[model samples]
Target: MKGNSLSQVYYRPIEAAIRWAGLLRFQHEIVAAIIDSRHLAVTLNCPRCDELRLYIDRIYDAIYHGELPYGQNGITIDDKSLWDSPDLTIRHVDLKRWMLNHYSGQRPAFLFSRGERIAHPVITLEAGNALLVEREALKSQLEQCRSQLRALQEQRKKHDQAPPACTLCPLSDRAEATYLHIIGAMLTLMLGRSPSGTPYSSFNSQEAIASALIAHHGHLMGITERTLQAKFAQARRKLQSAVS
Candidate 1:
């Protein structure tokens, strides 16, 4: 009377061993308790019922017909004392083997339903070699994508903070021309000129343009007056082309 009930002895202990070995990480339980001692078939909670069936078949084969005896104490299935004996335990080595075969590798049988009936060995070891490979590969790809995203974000931030460049002259191709366009727009607005030749005094226009240009492009500040005059004329022509 010190043992589990007949219902518990038959499959519950084995199910617990399977769970202890970490084979049932995603499933809630093996299955609802449906044990038929006559035919000895128990439905499992796994999606592939056939796979479960085959797995159970291997367990039965090992216990009832295979080389290994039932448990550590050499308890046979016919022993009535085993029915209620809570001390009943499968040997650790056997249990380890059972965990490995069922869950570990890409068993040829699991490739398709057609091979489900092809019973092979079942071992339980919670092997994570395959999962570790996939996890590392995914982690590498995710890090690479994150690095690319960060680079794009940095470039966008720099572009947003900088002043706009003219599309026609494009600061990349002609920084001087682009600067001239900006200086001309500032001067035209200040001179009260409405896109017409009826501008304010040309002297004030030139002086303000020079001041604004020097403030922005400080390299022009040290140039001689004659050279400055020539650069101003060139800037005016470039500004006209940009506006047109």
Candidate 2:
């Protein structure tokens, strides 16, 4: 009934010794139960909640860009929009009772001997569905982007002879140069060669090699740390595919 307190939900202490199940059991079970039953999915199923969540997302965008997203002039959240519809509010009350009765205590040995606690039942069904709803929202947004791109291409076709207002710079030459440099650096590192063209005492580790390559030739190779990271990721994928 109170404002959704996010600090406890978001900022749990991270211990290196803990595994995924240990940390995420609370949130995980909440989602699992919601998806397993339709009645428990009221928050996600509610139209008012969808509107409120979209409004909140715009509020976030306003914070970052100093304007509402999607070129909207003005946006606001009202009291009715903040909470659920009457039916859903009653459903929420019932849902909390159900969770408390069914999933509130320690699991028996038959269920899970690993001792996953369901103590602080602060999370609601709507909150549990937040990630799934957000993912769906992203898919919708991406579809909108693809549609806009196709529209732009169609518009460009109508102006066949005219050049676009912004000409896309050709990056093939620069990309080829960067690719060659990376290959050369990787070959040298693999062969245990130092910058002075002498053999090093021992081969460098993959992480060390990546770091050294980025530090020595990142600017010259027209690469940033992020670009080098992508290259490294591609290389790893290639190696994984070959092994598989």
Candidate 3:
């Protein structure tokens, strides 16, 4: 019906904002919902059991990856041998009507929400590859963080102090290290080179100290800047005492 417009559905600005920011791309199908090519929506399929079973996951994968993810289930089109089956026609239909008739059985009068749909450029294969690369890089950094945490733990053990009981303390230190690693990896991904002269050792040192304090205290040391400053001050005094 004249290409269902989201603006026609009427939503408050705040509701629209929350829907846009909070919705995951993978929850809906990506479709060009406008007459002229300005807006897009995550289309929901109607409730025919076969359509529901076949197209639901297809839509989700398309929204998530910016392209249709291929699979080879008996019901799916990717089963090349079943390409000629009459049951596998890919039809693009009116999203609003589909939701009304199929999802709600025409019960909910308003099928389209103004802010529920968002327009994004389709992700190219290169972009998907780049994401995979970043994911691998994050995993590698996580491993490095684990190794660094182990080394720090060993170092702390060598000193004349009781061993820590709080496991989260070491995990928090590892998370901090991983956070830096993620930042570095992002920089490398965007700039096509590693960031120059960032002090990896010093970065780990800060995390090590933070972890040590948390291990001793059994909680996040503090939230306020002043409180953190006090903790650091205390740590410095303790270090001096140990040396003396």
Candidate 4:
């Protein structure tokens, strides 16, 4: 009845097969690049779907001839639930061997379809291992971003007591209020955390959290590293002035 129970027992094998086939490699690469500088040097590319479609066609053929148990009408093997379930480990192993034996090389185009040129993209053993490593790194970065966002929210709450009165009391009083609000907004954007627990807010989404971490640390957020360093220097100067 539990969600994870089904995943471990029934869906894991299929999921592993899909992963090994490199279906989710792009997301893995993005996450890995965010977490480690070394990963940034690694080039990640998605396997062409046309190639995967050919494998699916072969699977259908095996099922049709009773070489494999499931078929096109049975349990839809391509569903994410089946792919992610742990129960499929043995199935995945068997499937991997089957794939390697029959689909590992650039097969003749005529065998796949009449009068069509097709290349079955083969993944070298080394590339498969690297993809697994990159996926783990991405999972790590997601966890780290979640923790960092939590800490920033706590800090914001502690600092939310009251705004200090403006020193220039007579001239442009609203300007100081606007400045403080702008600074608060920037901090929230940088931290990607919401204190109000709103469901639809950008801070709650995976993409927002991922983007913020990538921007701040991954060197992919458009701003140059030099700009970030300069901002850090300016922040330190402002802090020192406040203390003095």
Candidate 5:
């Protein structure tokens, strides 16, 4: 999204927002319903939206850093990969139909009692910021701690005669190993079919592969697709560092 002196909001396609919802802590349907881009873009760009994105980013950090959080149910990622599967797509259609039937998107909301119009819903920025500041501060402190932990782990590995890579990194578990396998499977699929009618793997796009795996193995542990992706990326970086 592009931001200017007067405005920061832009009408990204609803799909873009939905995909973001899949990655972040928010519900896709609620994000789809409330994020009135036309309304937001024309008006003063919300400071609230900025806070929202930052909030999501903090949650993203927690998930990718292998931290488990409790409480804050409203804001937790809950470790579910919300990929754009067929079931989710249908819900999108259903929500659109219900919204269209209930109200007109082209027009503003009418308050018959007060006779006021809210073309786009407006929220007080200060109140939301007040609620978020304390949590945000705590999250910042937590991120600092994680960075220190990683640094200490690396330093310890340098002097020691290597107990194990997993001990040094402290970044992998059985579940994460499964996620890594999913990443490898995605790569195999990207390689495509072999010559002699021997079936190999299918589907491309790492995000899609992770999502599909989550769908099939919902019983299996998972976090955000982006988290799985982050894990895959971390593995690659470590491998590259070793090779170089």
Candidate 6:
């Protein structure tokens, strides 16, 4: 188990080989196998679940599914080398075990979830492979940003095409609802700024505001600014009277 490549036990380890208990051997062993980028990506970015549990689950799944396994030991890159040369790729990550002695907290899982360095490197290669973790984190962030952008754009589109509610005049019934809508559309489209974000220096005249309303929504409303001038003037006078 010396290289980066995954290995089977040369075959499956027998029950005795796997179960032997001694200072030199353990029932379960973690082989420093490379996990796929996709699985690691999900584990890193999962929002609701415990991050430590998420990381553990990913590693366990890889082992269970045989993506990574405890390969045979003392693998050499060169078959002819007389000296002891262990393959760096599949090497046992036992080199980094010293970090564990530093962790005395009872809730190490929680600490690991919070990304405490006292956590084991086996939880993920995240400690060593910063770029891989960062890539996944940034990709997830980018997707969220794109989603928010899409929602904002949709809201802006609807807002541009529609008018805000008219609170100035509350007609009791739809008996004259058409006038309410006209006023609303006028106020929405011409006051201060148009839906297109255009600033207007003056849109005080009923004729001018009505003309803009008609130009924008004439076909759908089936009404002309000429017919609305009287109603518009009546509303304007009411507003002026109230203010004065």
Per-residue lDDT over 100-119 for candidate 1, one digit per residue giving the tens place of the 0 to 100 score? 55544433221223343245
Per-residue accuracy of model 3 over 23-60 as CA lDDT, tens digit each: 32322332323111212333433233243333344334
Model 2 residue 107 lDDT score: 32
Range of the 10 consecutive residues with the lowest summed lDDT in candidate 2: 9-18
lDDT of 4: 0.41
User: Mind giving the per-residue lDDT tens digits that candidate 2 earns over 1-244?
Assistant: 1122211211111110011123222333333334321123444432243433343333333324423211111122223332222111112222223324544442322223233334342455776587567556545654564465355335534544345653454548666454445444443335454333444323456566557655754544324566656766665555445446
Candidate 2 lDDT score at position 60: 35
Question: Against the unseen true structure, what C-alpha lDDT does each candidate score?
Answer: 0.45, 0.37, 0.37, 0.41, 0.39, 0.37
RMSD of each predicted structure: 21.7, 24.1, 18.2, 21.1, 26.5, 18.3
Residue-level lDDT for 98 in candidate 4: 54
Question: Which of the predicted structures, 4 or 5, would earn the higher lDDT when compared with the native?
Answer: 4
The ten-residue window of minimal lDDT in model 5 covers 2-11
What's each prediction's TM-score?
0.26, 0.20, 0.26, 0.25, 0.21, 0.21
Considering TM-score, which of the candidate structures 2 and 5 is the better prediction for this target?
A: 5
State the lDDT at 94 in candidate 3.
28
Q: Give lDDT for model 6.
A: 0.37
For residue 204, give model 6's deviation from the true position in Å.
6.5
Stretches of candidate 3 above 4 Å error?
Answer: 1-118, 161-244
Model 6 lDDT tens row, 107-220:
222113335434533433554386555556545654564465356435535645565563354546553453344444344334444333444325655567568657865663
Candidate 5: global Cα-lDDT? 0.39
- Between candidates 1 and 6, the one scoring higher on lDDT is 1
Model 1 TM-score relative to the real fold = 0.26
| Cα-based lDDT at residue 109, candidate 4 | 26
lDDT of 3: 0.37
TM-score winner between candidates 1 and 5:
1
